[model samples]
Target: MDFGCDPGEWTDAWSATGISHHWALGTGHCIAELKALADLMDVEFVEVDPA
Candidate 1:
């Protein structure tokens, strides 16, 4: 699944559905922080070209 820019707000949604992986495009500003949050949730984080 993909959580564009609201990863934090979507945590509950992700957990409810048992999602463990996601792609976050155009997250250059907070990629590191997002990755850390994903790690805390035991989810895999992938980066992709936003273009």
Candidate 2:
């Protein structure tokens, strides 16, 4: 996922998919982490409104 803020804490992209996912994990992993999940999935020919 997009752990851009915590560069040191992020794992490689390959594992987090098809393995499992976490949302609202804890105080340590808060809103930004949830926001990161949005970029985790990409669909071809699909456009999503930011709103």
Q: What is the TM-score of each candidate against the true structure?
A: 0.43, 0.22
Error of 1 at 40 (Å): 0.5
lDDT of 1 by residue, 4-47 (tens): 65878777675788754654544588888988888999987787
Steric clash count of candidate 1? 0
In model 2, pairs of residues that clash are: none
Candidate 1 regions exceeding 4 Å error are 1-26
Question: lDDT of candidate 1 vs native?
Answer: 0.71
Model 2 Cα shift for residue 25 (angstroms): 11
C-alpha local distance difference test of each model:
0.71, 0.44
Looking at candidate 1, the ten consecutive residues that score lowest on lDDT are 18-27
